[model samples]
Target: MNPYVIVSILVAYFGVLMVIAYFTSRNADTQTFFTANKKSPWYLVAFGMIGTSLSGVTFISVPGNVGNTQFAYFQFVLGNLVGYLVIATVLMPLYYRLNLVSIYTYLEQRFGFWSYKTGSFFFLLSRTIGAAFRLFLVAAVLQIGVFQQWGIPFSVNVLITIFLIWIYTFQGGIKTIVWTDTFQTFFLVSAVAISVYLISKELGLSLGQMVATVRESEYGQIFHWDPKSSKYFWKQFIAGAFIAIAMTGLDQDLMQKNLTCKNLQDAQKNMLSFCTVFVVVNLLFLTLGALLYLFAESRGIAIPGRTDYLYPTLALKSFGLLAAVFFLLGITASSYASADSALAALTTAFCIDFLNFDKRTEEDRKKIKFRVHVGFSVLLYLIILIFEALNDESVVTAVFTAAGYTYGPLLGLFAFGMLTRLPVRDRFVPLICVISPILCYIINKNSEAWLNGYRFGFEILILNGFLTFLGLLLLSKKRVAEPEVIPGE
Candidate 1:
């Protein structure tokens, strides 16, 4: 891969994105930016979600995990299916009934200002950090692999990369994102599919043979029923489900796209479609990993130390320049798709929940939205740099762990509202939500001793939620409402 060629492709690719942002920004007043006027086509929303659900993390991390992150990760995918059902049946109805622009407003309506702030705060803390970390993975590749070798400063590359995300997403929030994300998913999935075909071709294997090969690989195992560790079957299964629920169903970033759909059925349809594509897309990446490992075995190319790099390095080795071009485009698409949406969601949540800008007109709110968008971009820039400075473990692993901690409040809020009948003290709800994860962290830190040598699985979300639920339980008063319980039993 020529350095100049890679840079040129990246430049051209982002130029397309700028056009998307510019045109979308044309009529992107507050409502158009935030809500897409609630007129976006469901099919397009569904299509765009494919990219949001799977980011550059999915592009790089999913396949890499096929070999390294254990074979049992498919348990998470199964959990996602369950979580989507929960979202469709439970969360969507509530959102639709209330007609929420920022979903956190439901917290205020249900539990009061405290709960609303709690939900929004958790979203900001977790999402901002997670998005920054995600963008960092792509930045690492572009900076060290591309820019550093080309004598461009790493900071400058990071700035340019993040600036591009803000440029496109700062306008038309959910509305612009729907179309651009659709465009991005096209190249992202197509590039992966083409690379898969080429890889299969190189090995002289048909699609069936490719599938067969992965099935035979060590990465094929999808379940481990142990309750004691991260691989425990039921534990992982539930944890995986909540991860999907929190990260996708509950998180504003993913749901913003889903919310753009015209109705709950459409959003549910979008979720099902996204999940269907997700399973296959992951299989595609896993199969690619199997092929790459096989290729390495055949050609004696030493695999990289980090499995995450397997795809990029393998693509570099196995494909021609044109394929490489598509590979970078895929990377750009995946990274930007998730990152841009996150920024938009963060800004939307801030404007709606914290600032109450929904009551204001577009002319009065435009500057505020732009300022918040830029502020988030800078916040993410700082976080990504910190991750770089630390230079610790894999960024993807950190992301999964962060999801457990950050999304705990979402799980807690929903569980408290749905599973219990206690009337929450609205003013104290935020404190309860805030205390839950930190308590979880402390318990998680000392669990080995606290649980009498019973350790927790890496999906600490279960514990986080239970802790939050318990806190809410303690804070909430059992109030007898007019018996309106529906006869589900």
Candidate 2:
């Protein structure tokens, strides 16, 4: 593959997005920047979310998983189905009732400033780390495909990539994100669909043959009963459910779009719309993986140790020009879809939550937004540098594991407040949330010694939630000042 050609294509693609950023981001108010004026077409938000949720990490990672990582990624989607239901019914109502600008505001009402700040801090930390990792995976490809080919350092490449994201998002933030994400999502999925068909053709299998092969393979089985292991079916399914709700429902990047729906009824429709697309799109990617496996077997292609490279390698090896372009375009589209929105949301949350820009004058708001945007770009870039230094398959996996801890408290805090009418001790709220997760981590680490090699899996979320719930029971004292919910029209 001519790396120059790929680089040129990517540069051109970004130029197009910048043009988009210029127009969509014009005359932005704070409300417009943060929530698209809370009037984005719900259907469009639903479509755009496919891009945000399924990053380049997912683009490369999910299909490759089918052959290497037990193919149980599909089972996670099953959990997602249940998770989406809970979010639509449970989380959505709470968010709507509060008419919250930032989701973490609910923590303030349920607990206090300390707890509110605590939750937002976790979200900021977790999201920054999580977004960096996602971009890190895409960075690996860019480093190889563009920068290295042009004799540029990977760090330089990372800076430039993040810089581009920052450039477009600074003006409009989420307002620009919803529409840009829709464009990126379309390209990403289209690229995947094209590459899959081309790869299938090269393998000499029609689409029908490919589907039949996957259904018969070991990778296709969706359920497992062994609770003792991480790959076991039920643990994963349950884990998948919790992961979906926590990551998607509680996540600002995803939920911000949900909140943009014109009304609760429309928002509910958007969730269902997103859910259906999520399942179908994942199935398409899985089928692409199955096709790759069958093709490799038929031609005796040596599969790489890292399953993530399957799509790229196959594209490069077979039917040269079109396949390579398809692979590159798909991967690029996937990365930008998620990463750009991430930059927007990170800026939105920090500006809204911690900075209290609502209290500031217009000039101060712009000044603070600029400084914060620049600072975060630097911070996220540094994290990507470390991610590159570690540069192993398991390193990205570990990054996810670490971020997983942050969600444990989010789950616990939100569950306690929403499910129970009981007041949480406002003063101790932050302390309890912090303590519960750390203790959960300790128990998770020592479980082998504590229970004779008994390790926790997805159910650790349940434990973490339970501990926070118990702590809330122990700590909460006076009822809050009159509930802060303002009546909606």
Candidate 3:
């Protein structure tokens, strides 16, 4: 519970990451940073991705969310299972065939210059906001757990947080992230597993009794059948599939890891392996959530007003020093695991997608990559400050909500390119992508009133993508009979 201990744990943890970065990055060049020289182990990528995918949001929010939503989030996880299958079978193959450094280049091949840029732009936007939201949760926790004791400002906390990520990632990039995330994921998963055991011990429940207690408790419910509620099973399941496709399959931060694999088959294997683990890990989070709520009720501890605070509050103030240490480690590992990857992917995307790094000389590429990495680091820092000013909702909910709008166009763009043979008005692609999310925002805001009390949940992403798809359709034309040769094919 001591603030000094929390700081020491954090310092020591980063020290380890610095060591890893140094070794992994020793002979690193742009190729090593961008694609890990296309030699990352499938199993390592699969395992490390657990930390990247879950991040701090799941570490804190999902379990805390159990008090309110119970196990309904699992429905979404099931949907994610289906979505991951789609990614493995469908999306990954296309990315592999294209030999894409940035997946957005597929858009350029399929559609045109504008469409490619549009897809990459949305990725940049979606990832920036999403990463900031994740880091904000961890930063808020650090402030309360360590900085607040020392009277440090939140702005200083944000800078320090982003700087740690940049320092480790600036050289090794995805190569460093692949290994560091694996290490962090071990701690992340262990933290939850150990916390669950400690809570069971505190509650005097055996393993069987713990399962039975969670199963029988009010928080155990996982399905909602109501057609209008956001948690409706079908809605969440379907949304989960598309969310996986859009956020992971379509995302650069995640796909960059996948692309680092030696071949398409390895990437597919990685995805399938990751999917099974992803589902099980989420269920574990849901179980931990139920246990947390149960522990709170039994101990007469008041849940915090912000559910995001519940886990940190108990671990720091109630559970002994051991829980506090793992909680800090788990959160830090999970958060930076995701954040560091995002920083690398952001740099990679900008350098490759926007800056034409491939066309540049080696020395020029090095300087540009360094500056862009630093630029995005500063950008993330600024956005976290903005989130602290404006955000009032659970971070998980906010992330999904934002993804619904931002990633929707990516879903739409990819679907249009793959599902249809029609040639689009390439110049008009940006306009359609822009209009889709704005329309989604309007529809979501008035859905309950306009649709007879129908609340939009994660399914809003599906609707957003559909609207974008439709918009693209309107702008499409019958394909010319001439066989078109894609550049570099």
Q: Rate the local accuracy (lDDT) of all candidates.
A: 0.78, 0.79, 0.92
Over 1-489, each residue of candidate 3 has an lDDT whose tens digit, in order, gives 788899889989999999999999998999999999999999999999999999999999999998888999999999999999989988888888878899999888788899999999999999999999999989999999988999999999999999999999999999999999999999999999888888889899999999999999999999989998888999999999999999999999999999999999999999999988898889888998898899999989899999999999998988898888999999999999999999999999999999989999989999999999999999999999999999888899999999999999999989887877777999999999999899999998998899999989998899989998999899888874122323213
Off by over 4 Å in 1: 448-455, 480-489
Compared to the true structure, candidate 1 yields what TM-score? 0.94
lDDT of 2 by residue, 48-149 (tens): 999888888778877777776556667767887999999998889879888877899888876678878888887888788888888877777777666776
Candidate 2 RMSD to the real structure: 2.4
Which 10 consecutive residues of model 3 have the lowest summed lDDT? 480-489
Error in Å for residue 403 of model 3: 0.1
Q: How high is each candidate's TM-score?
A: 0.94, 0.93, 0.98
Q: RMSDs, each prediction? A: 2.4, 2.4, 1.7
By TM-score, the better pick of 1 and 3 is: 3
Q: At residue 207, what lDDT does model 1 achieve?
A: 83
Please identify model 2 stretches exceeding 4 Å from their true place. Answer: 394-396, 478-489
- Itemize residue pairs with steric clashes in candidate 2: 224-233, 425-476
True-structure lDDT of candidate 3:
0.92
